[model samples]
Target chain A: GAGVSQSPSNKVTEKGKDVELRCDPISGHTALYWYRQSLGQGLEFLIYFQGNSAPDKSGLPSDRFSAERTGGSVSTLTIQRTQQEDSAVYLCASSLDSLPADTQYFGPGTRLTVL
Target chain B: AQSVSQHNHHVILSEAASLELGCNYSYGGTVNLFWYVQYPGQHLQLLLKYFSGDPLVKGIKGFEAEFIKSKFSFNLRKPSVQWSDTAEYFCAVKQALSQGNLIFGKGTKLSVKP
Candidate 1:
């Protein structure tokens, strides 16, 4: 079985630019999550999607951070007007369902650097 | 707010030495505990998890964690650690039966000398 996977293993962009990071969850997974890992903030949850609908977006640091999932399979996180503080590793995870006990499978992550 | 705390920022030990990493959470209700490991250049992987049942939960690669509700703690332990066991360990907690996200602690890096 293929685990969750993210695209653009590494991205370097200029400040104020927009960057899109993609994630592909495993087949049959109904719960998808996006998180950010940085030196200053550690690991922080950004959003969660259950079957293409986001029910939790509380972790988004600012309005510029947004994510969407389609068909319950693929998700894209877009950061508008990226800032230097946005330089971090973006991680994606998926689970069978939204149950608290269900284990989340993580992806390799996309390392984004805003210059 | 719910939060998790890892007592140690880093741990260094010789091969065959015992290993213990302490973790505590701030939530007061029922919770799900998890220990995740990330080896060099690898994605985060589950080391162990405790949802319910026995307090002692064993996971892959000879790893185990003890969930103590009274102390609000879930500590990871390994009797004998190998050089290959060097990695970063993370403790996470989720409020049981809630749709909330998991709260993670600052990871503890372990360095092992063979």
Candidate 2:
């Protein structure tokens, strides 16, 4: 079975520029999540989507961060006016269902660097 | 606010040595516990998870974790570690039966010497 996959494993961009990261969840997965990992820090919850609808997006740091899923399969995380602090690894995960206990399969992640 | 804590930032051991990593959560209600491992240049992978049932749960690659509700802890352990076991380990928790977003602790890096 194909695992969750992310595109542009690494991205380097200038400050104030906008960037988009893509994630493809496994087939039949109904739950998708986005998280960010800063250098030497823990993974920070960003947003979540259940079958193309996001019910909880409180973890988003600010209005600059936004994510959306389409057809319950692919998701895109967008950061507007990137700042130096926004440089981090963006991770995506998906589960068979939206249950809290369902194991999440993670993607390789997109490392974004803001210069 | 709910949060997960990993006490050890890094651990170094020789091959075949016993390994233990401590994790604690601050949530007061029922929660799901998980341990994830990321080897060098690899995506994060599930090592084990605890939702309900026995406190002691075994996972892939001979790993096991003990979930102690009283102490609000879920600690990962391995009888023996090989060089291949070197990786970054993360502890995560989420409120049971609620939204599926996870709160993760700062990962602990394990370095093994063969």
Candidate 3:
């Protein structure tokens, strides 16, 4: 079975530019999550989506960051007016469900560099 | 708010040596614990997880973690390590019965000398 996949393995852009990162979860996973991994922040959760319920955006650092999952499968994280501090490897994960017992599988991640 | 702490930032050991990586979370409620590993060029993968029944959970590659509720800790250990086992280990936690995100610690990088 295919694991999660993220597109544009590496992206470099100037500060204040907008970037969109895409993620395709496993075939039937209903729970999807986004995280950022940086030298300073380590790994931090950004957002989560479960079924048709409201997405959890509590972990999103600021309003400039937002994500959307369409058709309950693919997700895209967009950063508006990116800053140097936003440069990091963006990771996507998914599980069968939102249960605590279920394990989340991660993707290769897209490395975003704010120049 | 829940947070995870990994005691060591990095550890160096020789092959066949015993290994232990400490992890502690600050949450009084019931929680699920997980250990994830990432090889030098690979994506992160689940090593093991502890939900309820057994406190001692075994994972892939001869890795295991013990969940101590009273201590709020889940320490990963292995009796013998191989050079191939060198990687970054992350400890994560999520509140039980909630559809919350996993809170991860600043990972511990293990360097195994062959």
Please give the DockQ score of every candidate, comma-separated: 0.72, 0.90, 0.81
lDDT of 3: 0.93
lDDT computed for candidate 1: 0.94
Interface RMSD of 3: 1.1
Candidate order by decreasing lDDT: 2, 1, 3
lDDT of 2 by residue, B22-58 (tens): 9999999999999999999999999999999999999
For residue A35, give model 3's deviation from the true position in Å.
0.5
Chain B TM-score, candidates in order:
0.98, 0.99, 0.98
Q: DockQ rank, highest first?
A: 2, 3, 1
Which candidate has the highest DockQ of all? 2
Where does model 3 exceed 4 Å of error?
Answer: none
Itemize residue pairs with steric clashes in candidate 2. none
> Which tens-of-lDDT digit does each residue in B5-32 have in candidate 1?
9999989999999999999999999999
lDDT per residue as tens, model 3, B1-114: 889999999999999999999999999999999999999989999999999998999998889999999999999999999999999999999999888589999999999999
Per-candidate Cα lDDT values, in order, are 0.94, 0.96, 0.93
Regions of model 2 farther than 4 Å from truth:
none
Residue pairs with clashing backbones, model 1: none
Give the TM-score comparing model 1 with the true structure, all chains together: 0.98
